[model samples]
Target: MLINVPENVVPDALRGFAAVHTDLTVDVERRVIVRRGAPYDGQVGLVSGGGSGHEPLHGGFVGRGMLTAACPGEVFTSPVPDQMVRAAAAVDSGAGVLFIVKNYTGDVLNFDMAAELAEDEGVQVAKVLVNDDVAVTDSLYTAGRRGTGATLFVEKLAGAAADEGAPLDRVAGIARRVNEASRSFGVALSACSTPAKGGPTFDLPEGELELGVGIHGEPGRERRAMMTSGEIADVSVDAVVDDLQPDAPVLLLVNGMGATPLLELYGFAAEVHRAMGARKVSVARTLVGNYVTSLDMAGASVTICQADEELLRLWDAPVSTPALRWGC
Candidate 1:
């Protein structure tokens, strides 16, 4: 809670973000972040957003090879239709814009409304919903599986396709394919506090953790006593593997839920790899870090994306974003 005022948290952070990332244009008033050289003519525009706490996500991923524009809402709150409409309008390059929406109820409704509004404004728009979390079928914030770590996979692959001047439909198709090919599961070590709350958002007694937790602190499968990193990986990896049943080599994401450090993340990643090997799952690529987060929650999530040759090629494409950058 190192903020001036609870209400000004997002805007305040945007100012700092704009100052640091010169390649991005942060419209604090409108609460939208767009790449400096947007509207790439024949390239399909990629737009995605969500609540504010998940840094380096919809915002930090905005760049030449990822999101073209992002509309950030208040922490843990969905952005309004106006924000989405503005983002779509800003990035549409006549090749049309694609909205990459998470599967939350509020996000689904608002982005849907924005797509229609953008179409009315003569901007062709397509959308893909990401519902990769395999933890639960329903959660407090969603009627179906919640979107989690695999969002990074969808955004990167789709953005690469868009950057290649893929048509709107093709880019949308890639995004949908990535979502369908991915699955994620999360476990929380502790609860996170918001600027407004000024304290832990949820209570977890000592020596306990939440399994299959949601990004916004939503309840998961069940609570259990603290376990070793390897044990946690065994269960998490099992959850996704059972559901995915991948037939090809996969891309793995060992994502931190904000407060977890890299030291622990890398170690946990080792265990994840071990678990994957035990299941006879082949891993083609691995990414580890706080790409997708949940405020200051101390936990991590595992995402697995079954990758065909084409999917792997798109993933290997150059991406220059604030959080994830490589092959540049």
Candidate 2:
């Protein structure tokens, strides 16, 4: 919000992001971010995109063990079908392409249309819809559950499977299973300000919290007096566990909503660990950071994925992206 750029803020930001990550090549014209070496023969290409505000998401995630290409649209706006079509064409090998779409009305609609466009060019396209947020269903913008933190799990698990040369159907199935086993809940201390909007998306009085807040600043399940960090973690864990009934081993993601500092994120992670311990849930793997975030929103979200051996193995697989890198 404090930065200044030309009129085309999204494109300008993309140029800077591309400069820092040489492995990620940005098509300034198409607004698509592609991995340097992609479209591996017999491997399913993974393409995902959405609004631009949530960085280190669709774009920063473009690399090996993750997305093949990511097409970013204007802030909070769905990418046009052209971007997806071109990305699919560029990344699709004989094994086909997979579209990891979050469950939002505009995203679903546009991605579905893009699939049809790609099919016209003889590219086999499959899709996995992520609606893992256990917040208010059928929110103001989405038809059903709004996709949130759990999207990262789907991308990693499915991307690992795809990188292993799994066919489109197999990759889609893996992503679907991940989605089915995950749940998320969020709490917001304040709202985010988009460059275009020039103001916070929503308002919150001092010492108040919005529970189950969506990534796009949509109204949450409820608003109440602010609770301590520990209390917030307990409530968030309870909501996700109640929905998930997680297996013995669970993958936990304590995500900061953009503006939330890492110190606070780690603090919340500790609280979540204690809360899950009290509930008899085993924390198999933990990721604490801002993987999925709302723009400059002072908040955090918790995502839990019930992990089996297969899921854990896939999760531990090598991934090299700008925002997330490990085991590479």
Which has the greatest TM-score?
A: 1
Q: Per-residue CA lDDT of candidate 1, range 1-328, in tens?
A: 6889899999999999999999999999999999987888899999999998999888999997889999999999999999999988889889999999998989999999999999999999998999998888545655988888888999999999988889999999999999999999999999989888888888988799999998996656789999999999999999999999998999999999999999999999999999999999999999999988989999999999999999999999999999989999
lDDT of 2 by residue, 212-325 (tens): 998886658899998999999999999999988976699999999898999999999999999999999999999998888888888999999998999999999999999889
Query: TM-scores of all models?
Result: 0.98, 0.97
The TM-score of predicted model 2 comes to 0.97
Q: What's model 1's lDDT at 274?
A: 100
- Clashing pairs in model 1? none
